[model samples]
Target: MRFLQNLLSFKQPSVMRRIDIALIVAVIPHLPYLSGFILAFLFVSVIVIIYIKKVSKSLVNTFMVIGLLLIFISFYGELNYAGISRFSVFISLISAMLIYVVMLQRLSGRVNFYLLFSPALLLILSFFFYNTIPMLLYMIFAIFTFSTMLLWSVMEVNLGIVLKKSLSLFLLSLPIVLILFLLFPRVSFERASYGFTNDQMMRTSHDGTMSIGSDALLVPSQRIVMEILFDKKIPPASKLYFRGSTLYSKKAGVWKQIPQKMLHFKALQKRGEKTSYKVTLYPTFKKYIYTLDYSQRALEASKITDDHILLADKNTEKVKHYKATSYLDYINAEKLSAIKRESALDFNATDYPQLYTLAKALQDTSTNKSLLNLITYFKQSQLIYSLKPEIDENSPEESFLFKYKKGYCVHYASTFTLLSRALGIPSRVVTGYKSNREYVYKNYLIVRESDAHAWVELYLDGAWKRYDPTAYATSSDLLPKENQFLNDLSINYLYLKHIIENWVLEYTRDKQLNILKKLLEDSMFAFTFTFYVLSFIAIVLLAGLYFRRDKQVHPTQKIIDKLLKKLNKRGYKKDKDEDINTFLTAIDLAQIQEINTLYHKIRYARSSSTDEVKKLNKLIKGISSKNPKYP
Candidate 1:
């Protein structure tokens, strides 16, 4: 009976326990985003105060106030937009205050209840910022640790028992949480006056006009521009040219796209060998879809220009999906009008006399092989391909061709177009993604942002033929060879990333509906899902029951626990960090000293005889009898 009363009694949390709770509740969320200065400051402060003194309640309160002030100042102008930050700040402040309050004052029922449950709020907030798999693993550990601490804070219990109960509670709640998440109605109609509500939702910047002759080097954007889900066959890297826009007007060395009205779109007759695909495009804040070469739009409200480049009907600030079909290993046989031919062949001839002299000589040397001669010249001309290309802004074309000679796909494309036009061959620059390499998952091909490329297209044999001079540039030792191991690691990382994004993060309402439809179609899958869910629930309940069974305790441990409880009721509460000897010494109690000596033998020296257990229990009973209120 005395043991039962001791087991159910409340106790003050130790200094270490209070600090642990405060640190977790106040600091963990900000860990990922904390500055180096703040971390160093904290480290220095900890070292300075290590053995000087115990943690002061005043110090904790001061820090809490400072944190609150910083939060307010940081979010001064953006309070409306900083709702999440505000929530985190408030929780941290309350947790810190409660922890310090516990240290200085007696644990009132209200205060104890709030302290017990406040950390749970931090756990919920954790999900808002970090819902990734790694964070999920961390959360499991955190939930167990904090919940165990909470259990210990409120009641006098064995450490192992506290751990077991915490685990049981967490597991028991998991099934119900999952059930609620699945069955919860997320979509709702806002209002009705015959008016129902509708549901709604930079990953990359692809909207900027792809200017031709700018001396500024192209920065490689690894930010994903879009993802492609090929309906059928995935195109090879050599052939995957995602045509965006065609630049026809060239003046002052810079090439610009002709106005929308100036370009013409002819119907594509070669649909027999078409490859159908869907594009899940990231927001570029522009309408450009960056569709495949010779692409024809298959979805409504999608636009395809004469250049075979697809676009959304409106600017998209969010992810938008569209379907299109593109022909592979086929020429765009649409004959260019005389005006279009002139536009394609147009360039500033007066500006490039040196280039024209070279072009005319090549044209004269090989009349029938002008295009091939020009391509061979580019291949033979030791021009380096790089992200950071050096070209004089005043003479970008001349400097790129004759002087610097090092450039990216843009340089290769622009120079090749100028040379082709100089030779009177109809040519223009096409800027889009060259999504050659891709991760193939579940019959879908994934293309990322690094594939953004520019190339030239020349009119040959009554059809526009794609000429990738950048491929020629790569054939030369311009760029350093990629480390095979690093490349493979990167590919694997991307593959895993796309898997997570598609199956986890991007699993939308539509995907859920499709999954349900499939489950309905297959009775076996539905049955399997239902059976697993029910089994999970049953297993959770059984596990909880198993863990809830009476935990076996050593007789010596029981005696020590009873003694601690009796002392607590008599206003000689032992510090949680205090060992049996230290606590007894602090109390200066002769009776506790005898129990402490016996406990040490059983706990440390392996002396657990029945006589020792009875003796320790006898000492505990004497203490309890003297302090009857404790009993």
Candidate 2:
């Protein structure tokens, strides 16, 4: 029974027990992918058990220690799996837990209510020292947690006067902080301090081939990969194309990018008008940047290779904004060089014998240009269009052509390019996102990964003309309006994520210095310094105000004053301006005798005394501590 009573004692609640409960809740969402939901249910069951068992103090303490060990173990496991050390996370958790335990144990019932909430105060300070969170988010979370703790302490400790005064001080400090944040001169260093590499790009889509016996296709990833921004009148959603790599070679049933080679644009000058736009591309974990055809000029610091595609020398870790100028009316008719043509048309005759025979039969029926005939046949065929394609166990290409006949842009473009090459037409596969969703604030079209597509570009009439074999294969409603809405939401999300990456994650010394230089040049540095000084002064003033208010007579002191007044009304009046001891001696004989012994005991005590003076203290103690007559 004594052990049970200790477990239920509010003054001595086990710190480890609280930590155990918190750890169990925090780790439930991070279980193995397959077991996550099951583990969550099991954690909930544990919570129920803890509640029902009414665990003893010793058991609670034991569980808390076990929980701390498990938390450390989990942190190490995360470090191992992530291939990065989480020493800071481990240290912060341990420090926070230790500080919490110490504060709870040593400070209970001794300090003012705010002082008893030292654990929360230390946690806020930890966030600042750790630098594990964004400054803005850290400040917000700190304020929120601190405010919540303050409110809870006020309710639990009945510190209404302190709460009111603290709240007033907080309200007075907000405007000053806001003013400082806005006016501060931001500085950057010459060298960039932070950057993201291509390794961070979250790859969500697979290449042409699919692995057997794996659940690769159904692996759901919610990561937003890229955001595109375009200037000027928004292009029709159908005409928006984010052009990427041109794959002209296939070996072992896998599409490979052809080596970069120049293609002459004979009718480049024919375009009376040109459209120049900027693309703020997110890192796609691939080198290629999608742009329209016949690109004549690229922005500074970007490389325009022979294929008229733009490539950035630096890996695009965040949203990379670049300008591309493309001709709207240029014709690409430089026929493929003999070597290139042969390579483009090259395919293993023995591997796909049936496909080759079918292509030859179709070739014999065409009287016009082989490329034109192929294009016409594909546009006029009964091949269905669908995102879901049936994979054949025996032969994928054969099944796609003869039986299933329905697939995405990849299937259509792959089949078309291969068959065109068989019919003596040099064709290449181009992969990129098609269509853009416009954002209101950016005033630019945003593209997404779901818009990833494949099409064919054939060498024709002295230039390469784009031919989307899947264009005709897809109906207008193939992508539902709802899908487009979701795509829009995804693009917006990516844009916000890009902003966070650029402004927070990739914020570096160079950027900071640049900002400082700009501020100095604009004569804003003086204003910033003044603002900061003024704000600091204001905070100091507000803090002083709060301290002064807190230093006033405590509630216990008020009760002592009331007791003195009551004694005076009962004819044991203190002399006007008399000292406390003199006032006690002046009381009537009966009253003096009643309170003198108690007053001596309280006044000359070696340790700290309660607010109650000796006379009232003895009476209250007798009634409350012994007889309980006050109740």
Candidate 3:
């Protein structure tokens, strides 16, 4: 019981305990799958534990809990659609939080030992538990989180001392790191692409075949997946149709891509003035990339496939930044061949009976121009644009024509393509992201998956012309005009993600080498080397200063000083302030018995004399060695 009491009363406060709590708070944002309620309960319990143990008080705890809860709740809508992986993430977060708390309590108040080693321990344990997760990602999170904890611990222990030192070091290293990043020799090594592959597989738009049900629901995703930057000024919005795959054939209510072997790219007769632009694409895992009608020249990373469509070298997993130069006029001027024309017009009339009848009726009444006019007529009439359109049991196209006249970009684009094919006009569905009007940041345009769109490209008078029936159907929904607050927040978040992707994930060996080379060339090398040497010297100096501050005289020396002062006050004079060995020879054993004994021990003891020597030696020698008659 007494030991327990002492342990509880241990004067040193546990800095690790506080730090663990703080880390938990910081990590909650990343655990999207975890139920907010469960996390809320756990967080509250931790805060209560801290308060009960006198680590923190009620008010601060309440505010923290409330604030974190609000943040978690705000992301609930997104979480619902994010799928099961998010839930697994929450479980891992809970495990991490529990481990942090247990470890902190065990360490007590020894903050430095805990601060430096806890992360390493956590990283080891994380692997045992989260073996399924990628080690690289885990390492990244561990390094970042632990580094933050270390910084916090350093500040707490040494107050502002560590910060000042670190800042000085950072300033010295900054220029060197920058130079190395810039001037490093770059090699074009193949990089593994990253993005939502499952999202791509599930993506109906990428396949070019669109159903009213699936396509309608994807309209409001609003998550920007890629960004485009032009070397020159961005092209006009009307000319901006980032092309994916061209769906040349529709059979049995499905859109079909032209076989790669059958399709071929023809060189332009006279290449027009080429405009170069770079597209930083978010991975859809789909082969096709949207380019303006024809590309005269492409970067080494990209290839011109059939239909003048651009295909990346490999599937992308993340944001892929690649450059391409296109001759916009040459592509616009190319005539559609018979094979292309036949494929675009080849729709199975047997499968879509009503669509076939509609086409026949239009053809019977009017010419090719009238059939084109009919598309505008249908879009203008009663069709409404929406994210969630009413899905029916019958054929989706027939449903769109008869039932819910309302639909999204997919509905309009799909209907328009089918109608054009039925009217003997060569047309196909083009799928890719649409333009985002809001300028997100410098040299980047935010294109969200919700910006995923489908439009018809009709081969008109020997040239394929872009036609957006959905744009005509829903002009009001083109760009978000209202709800400026949400819009701004979303755009800002996307922009931050863009920067992280570009700066960190895309940071190559070339970039690192360049930074190092630049540092060498810049004379910053001298400054850096000098700074490191000075820093080492300063650390040693500070350590020496602290050591001196903590220094104390030995107990034996203190005792001797006190005895000498006492003897002087009593008028017992010693010749020259003699050393212990010389002074002991003259000191009378009978007088000042304890002092005489201490002096003998100091002069004769095998080991250096201390408080133990004074105490034990006086007991042994005072009675026997001192003559009591003189005292």
**500-540, model 1: which lDDT tens digit per residue?**
65555555566666667878898999999899989999998
Best by TM-score: 1
All models: lDDT?
0.64, 0.54, 0.58
What candidate 2 gets wrong by more than 4 Å, as runs, is 1-141, 144-201, 205-223, 260-285, 288-305, 308-339, 347-369, 391-399, 436-446, 474-631
Considering every candidate listed, which one attains the maximal lDDT? 1
Q: What range of 10 consecutive residues in model 1 has the weakest lDDT sum?
A: 191-200
Model 3's alpha-carbon lDDT is 0.58
For model 3, where is the 10-residue window of minimal lDDT?
Answer: 194-203
TM-score of each: 0.63, 0.54, 0.55
Number of backbone collisions per candidate: 0, 15, 17
lDDT of 2 by residue, 107-144 (tens): 22223434444445454434323222244465554554
lDDT of 3 by residue, 342-425 (tens): 788877787678878888767745445556676656856677776667766357777876677766776788787887887877
Task: List RMSD in Å for every model shown.
Answer: 12.0, 11.8, 15.6
Error of 1 at 429 (Å): 1.1
